[model samples]
Structures are given as structure tokens and as C-alpha cells.
Target chain A: MPRRVALEGSHAVSEAVRMADVDVIAAYPITPQTHIVERLAEMVANGELDAEFICVESEHSAMSAVVGAAACGARVFTCTAGQGLELMHEVLFVPSAMRLPVVAVIANRALSAPLNVWGDHSDVMAIRDCGWIQMFAENAQQAFDLTLCAYKVAERPDVLLPAMVHIDGFHVSHVVEPVLLPEEETVREFLPPSEYPFPLDPDRPVSMGCYGPPYIYTEVKKAQEVAIENSYEKVLETFKEFKDVFGREYRPVETYRVEDADMLLLMMGSYAETAMLAIDALRERGDNVGLVRLRLWRPFPAEELRNVLRGVKAVCVFERAISFGMGGPLCAEVRAALYHLPEGERPKVVSFVGGLGGRDVSVEEFEAMLRRAKERVSSDELEGFEFVGLRE
Target chain B: MRGELSWKELEVGAIVTEPGNAAEYRTGDWRSERPVRKQELCIMCGNCYIYCPEGCIVLKEGRYETDLYYCKGCGICANECPKGAIEMVEEGK
Candidate 1:
């Protein structure tokens, strides 16, 4: 039976992991993410969940342990944040390269020198090109929902790549919210039993993680690329199955109030929640403004993004992390996605960087940026990069 | 979990699973050469002893002897040794 409970986002994620019947969990405790591992430990201690929870020493060891477990044909999970994620950067490449179906929950936190535990995209962005399927959640509900969705998308035999579900640290991780927990039987029916194609069987032993010669290296990488590229269909199929089972549909890119709007704002993560508020406020004043929240980050949903923003006159990309001197990383990617479109159809996208280190972007400030962006669009003087909510 | 294994007279060769023991090798068990220190080149820097993946490299009378029984031969010791004190020749090569 489905359990109806007021659960925190972290607890909700833990609930889904428990329901998924993950065979092994290798984890370490980091701020914001510690709640998830704490809850999983409690479930194991109380016998509420039947699984092996390994208390690894460090984040690096945590990923390494999960990689071993997954390669050994066990459904595995782990969570980490901030500098802890930086420590595991090396092993992150191993799981995807070896094509082990491991899933990770990343509590999005600011990377630190002076040491801040707030939310940002720096940690996940640092590992963006590691060949893992990455997804961002807008709120606690999506945090819980996408946590389940990650397993299905990652474990597909055609797409045996590691996946990470990123949720803003304190905003979604520490916040309590109403989440609809699905029944165990329904989740089981939707997600098939994991069939480990390569398992450690004494009777049928095969080598894994072998040193390949140059002759086979390119072939190995080509297979992984094809697997991830082909995974788009499976992601859509599994999401449809999730919608059927849980009645909650999710898309790679979701548009809000964009039907008749000429101006659109492109953003991601928990900021999407605030952007929706901004959208609603603007619509009340008879302004044509909309928002597009990118859920999938890895596959670079180009066609879907273009289709949604093609008709819009102007687009503003609010990025949380800066790519050093180059400006907003997400804004650069969004502009590139629409670069090939016809001149008239291509929306004038203004890149804005804000919300780093858990800075709250007020709804009023968001509205002002929209007005400024529209002015830039009208005057044909839109700066390629603008830092929002800056003092100067 | 119960299986068939003869315990009465366990041969050394019985447990040392060689390549082609099965159709394919479990690369998980593949290890590097067990470093046998040439006493003449010994500089008791203890690099090999500290960096050995299996921690089987030990100092005996100012010389290092790597335990072949447990060593996977990752060659961490040979690679980490600052001096040319340890050489990792392939086992059974």
C-alpha cells in the first residue's frame, strides 16, 4: 500500500531508495546530505529495510565501494556533497567508464575555500563531463520522484551509465514537504528486477575493468556514447511508466505559462520554484513572461529546448555557477543550443549569474531583471553576461 | 552457499587460480608483480613497504620480501619507491 506521510525531502529520497530494494548502499556523511544516510541507517537498524548499508570512510571510498558492489551485480546507491564530492572526482570517472549501473544522490552545495555549507551548482558542475546521467529537481516532490526515476534511467541495459540526482542543499534537503509515497508493489512492477549481465559467478567467470589496447579503446567509448544517446527513448518510456504508476509525469524540459508569452526565463534546480512565483506575479500585471526548468542536464536536451523557446522573443538564462572569466556555464550552453536556429526565431538570451552560496533571489529582483532583459531585447543592446542581484 | 571442495589434502596449486582456469578471468583478482627486493639495491626508504596495495611487502634483516600469497602485484611499491630499489618483474613471465 502507498504510504501517505509528511516527509522531508531527504527522508522522501531515502524512502524511495528503500522501496527500490537497492541491494547495497555505500555512503559517507556530509552536511545536508547527512540526513539521507542517517535515515537509511535507521531503516537498516530498525529492520524496516532489508539491505546492506556500508559505512565507508570517505566520499572517495564511498563511490569506490559502490562501484565494486554495482559491478558485482548489486543495485547500489550513495550520497555526497561539497568538498566530499571533490574528493570522489577520480573514482567518478571509473564507474561510468566501466559502465557500472550505480546511482548517486548529490545534495547540491557550494564548493568552499573559506568553507560554506549552503547550496550551489559548483559541485555537480565540476563533474558535468564525467559521462554520468545528471538530473536536477525543482522541489522536494521532484527530489523524491526523480530519485526513483534515476534508477530506472541508469540501470537500463542499453544505458548502463552512472546517474546523479541533484537537489539544492538546505532548500530542498532540509525542508519538510508533503510527498506522495508510492506502494512497494507498484514500484516493483514499474521497475523490473535488476539483471546483472556480468556477475561474479564461479561457474562463469569473466574479467571486468580490463586494460584495453588502443585497438579496442575507441570501440569501448563508442559503445558508451551510443548507450547514453540511445537512452533518451528509455528515459521517456520509464517516465511514462512512472506517470502511469504514480500519476506524476516528468519531462526533460518543463515550460510554465509559456503558451502566449514572448519572454522566457531559463533556470534550473530549486530556483525554478521561485521563478514560477515570479512568472505568476508578472502574469498578474498582464505581462508575457514564462519559465523553462531543465530537468535533464547530461544529454543536453537541444531539440526540446529549441522547440520551447523558438517562438519567444527573448530568453534570460539564470545560472548559479560561473565558468571563471567566461561567465555563466548554463547560459553559454543555452545560447549554443539555440545558435543554429533561424535569426528571427532565435530568442535573444541574456545570461545572468546569481544564487551562488545559497543567496536568495527575491521575486522583486527577478521581475526587475525581466524588465531589464526586455529593454535589452528592445534596444538590441543585451549584454551576453549579466550578474543578477549584484551590489554594483 | 554450501559447495564441494576437498579439504583433506589441499594442494598449493588448488587455490592458486591461474589464467584460463575458467573461460575468462575475473579481472577483479588480477594483481601486480610481488616485489622481491634485491638486497644489493636496498635503500631502507620503506616506500615499497608503505605503498604496497596488499600491505604484504615486509622488511626482514634490512631487506624487503613481498608475500606472494596475498600480493596482487599492483606495483604501487615499485612505482612509489623514490630510489631504484624495487623492480617489479612479471610473476611467472
Candidate 2:
């Protein structure tokens, strides 16, 4: 039997790391993300978890240390958010390119300019192409579960790439919720000892991180892209195995109340649950509104998304990050995914950016957005994007 | 020579499995000019040997000779030689 305990989202993520029995944890402290690593440091200090907790000076060093540790065949864990993630931008490519299975938890936060430490998708969106398997957790429980699943997916012999689990900063990372804490024996059975095929050992003497000149650079990039693209199947397989062992189900894209509904709101992260409440209220009032929560960001579930939006008349994409000059990052991907659909079959996508800088997107706000989307769908004015809850 | 293998034929992460494979790649082809040794002017101080960027300069029978197979003709040997025994001569001259 598993223990049901109330844990802060950051602590929940640390609990998952503990369950994974990570060998090395290299992390630098950052807002919302600091708690996750802080708990792990205590675990290491208390000798409850036998792992190397490297307290690095900066996020760049944190990622660098994990890359080096993972290269040495150690199952490593790291956590960061906001500016810290941007700081690790250059080193982010090294782990994926070298095929190191380093698992990182990102407590998603907004980028600077105003220097805000609030929940948003800007940080994760910036590194979407960093060649890691990225997933979003809607709540604390999912954050805990996804962190465990990340290890199983990343360490697979076929997919030796790094993975990142994104939990919304403050919104989810600071909230306390009941989480099913599984036993070590159960997790060990589910996620066995990670076996790195190409560990840096003196006896083996295998060369890694070789410079790729022009002649081989394209080939190397192609291989890395193909590896990440093909990792979707392995991700689903691991999720299924996790469901069987842990009795909790997860999918790349999860839908709620879409049956017979005409309008669907698309979202990711913790706000999806809040949006569900809005959908419920709308449904109670006889409105045809539904919600589609995108769980997987990378290897973007195009097929699954298209299937879910098959007959829906309109989709309102609520994004927390903007692409500047363009609209939302996720809204653009959603449009591209549905671009090939026949003119008659496709739905009108209304893009809206909201909940930025930790602004609370209330139920009333979601209802109003739905009304505006429906109005635009009828008027055929659902072309450009809008910034919701903006004062101006 | 690595161009012989297609992208699919290469290793997963473009890892160089064989140690010291850089020796097989002759970077000397990139040279527009080659370094020549003025044997009489040479003091045998081994500055050229120490300064050769590619480590292509080797001691042969108590004298330094640049192995053109690996030398990139960077002129570092000529530039650093204390006695001016090394000269950057146009290739094939």
C-alpha cells in the first residue's frame, strides 16, 4: 500500500527523485525550484538517500556537472527555473547531443525584463528545441509521477537522451496536495537500475563529445533529431508500464468533456485544472465548451491533438508565453499541426495569451474568453491573437 | 574519408569510438604554404618541435623534421623558431 500524504509540489518532485534513487544531483538554487533541491540536499545530508548532492555555484555549472556525471554512468537529477534555465541554455545542448540520460525538473517561471519570479511557460518555451523530452505536470501528483516516468523513458537503451518535467512556478510548485508516495521496492521494480551503454571508464576507454566538423555535423544533428522524434513511442510505452505497475494513467494529451462539445479550450500545466472548472460552469449553463490539456510539449502530439479536435468547431489556445512579433509559441505549433486538414474539416483556432507573471486567470475570465472565441468563430474574426487580463 | 559513411551508417551520437582517429585525418591538405627547414641555420633548440600546433614536428636522427602528413602549415613553427631555421615556403616550391 502506498502512503497518501500532503506535500508541497516542489517537495513532491523531490519525493519522486528520491523514489528514482538518483545517484547524483547537481543543482543551483532558484525561486520555486530551490525547494525541490533543498529537500534533496537534506535527504543526502541525513543519509536517508545515498546520493551525491553537488551544490553548484550557478545553473550553468549545475547542468555541466550533471552532464559530466551522467556521462560517467551515474543516474543524475537536477532542478531549475526562470533565469537559471536561461543561464543553462548553452550547456543544455551538450547532454542531449552526447546522449546523456540526465533528468531535470523545471519549476516553470517567466523570463526577466521586469524580473518577475512568477509562473509561466516562457522559460520552458525558450528551450523547446534543446533536444530533450519535455512534459508538463498539471498538478503536484502529476509532477511526482512524471518525474519518475522521465527516468524510465530517458535511460532506455534505444533513447539515451535527457528529459525535463515542467511544473508551473508558485502555481503548482508552491501548492500542497495529497500525493500517493510509492514504496522504494515498488519504484525499483518499475524503474530498474539505469544501464548506460557508453560510460566513461578507464578500462573501457570509449571516446565521447568529439568535435563534429562540417563533414559530420549535419549527420550528427540528424541522428539526434531522429532519436528524439522516435522517443514518443518509448515515452508512451513507459507511461503504459507505469500505469500497470502504479495504477495511475497518463497520456501525452488528455481531454475532458469534449464529447458532443463544439468549442474546446487548449492549455497546459496547472491552469488546465482551473480551466476545467470554467468548462464545467459553461457546460452547466448548456454551453458546448470542453478542455484539452497538452501534457507532452516536445515530440508534440500532433496526431493525438488532431484526433481530439476532429469535429470541434473552434479551439481557444490559452498560452502563458508570447513569441514576440508572432503570437504564442504553443498556438503556432497547434496551428501547424492542423494545417494539413481539409478546409471544411478544420476548426478555427483562437489564440489568447493569459496568466502571465502569475496573474490569476479566474473562472470569470475563462468564461469571458470562451464567449469572445465563440463570437469570433461566428464573425470569422478569429485570426489574430489577444492578450487576456491585460490592463491596456 | 569519413564522408564515405552516410549519416545513417554513423554512430548514434556521432561518437568517435576509435581512440586517436584524428591521426587518420590529414589536416595538412588545408595548407596553402608548407614550412621548410634551413638545416644549416638550425640550432637544434627544439623550439619548432615545441611550437608546432599539430605536433607534426618530430625529432628524426637528432634533427627536427615536420611530418607533412599531419602538419596544417600554420607557420607557428617558423614564427616561433629562435634561430629562423624554419621558413614558410609556398607549397610545391
DockQ of each: 0.03, 0.54
TM-score of each: 0.80, 0.91
Residue A160 shift from truth in candidate 2, angstroms: 0.7
Give the Å shift of residue B86 in candidate 1: 28
Give me the candidate number with maximum DockQ: 2
Model 1 CA RMSD to the hidden true structure, in angstroms = 10.4
* lDDT at residue A340 of model 2 (Cα atoms): 89
Fnat for the candidates in order: 0.00, 0.67
lDDT of 2 by residue, A236-271 (tens): 999999999999999999999998989999999998
As a TM-score, model 1 comes out at 0.80
C-alpha lDDT score of every prediction, in listed order: 0.81, 0.91
Candidate 1, residues A1-392: lDDT per residue as tens digits?
A: 56667888899889989988898998999998999999999998899888899998999999999999987889999999988899999999888877788899999999987588999898888888888888898777888889889998888876777889999999899999888887788888777767767665676656566654444455566666666777777778878988988888999899899988989999889888888889999999999999999988987788989999896899988878878878888888888999999989998888788888888888888898898888888988766577778887
Residue A277 of model 2, lDDT score: 90
lDDT of 2 at B50: 83
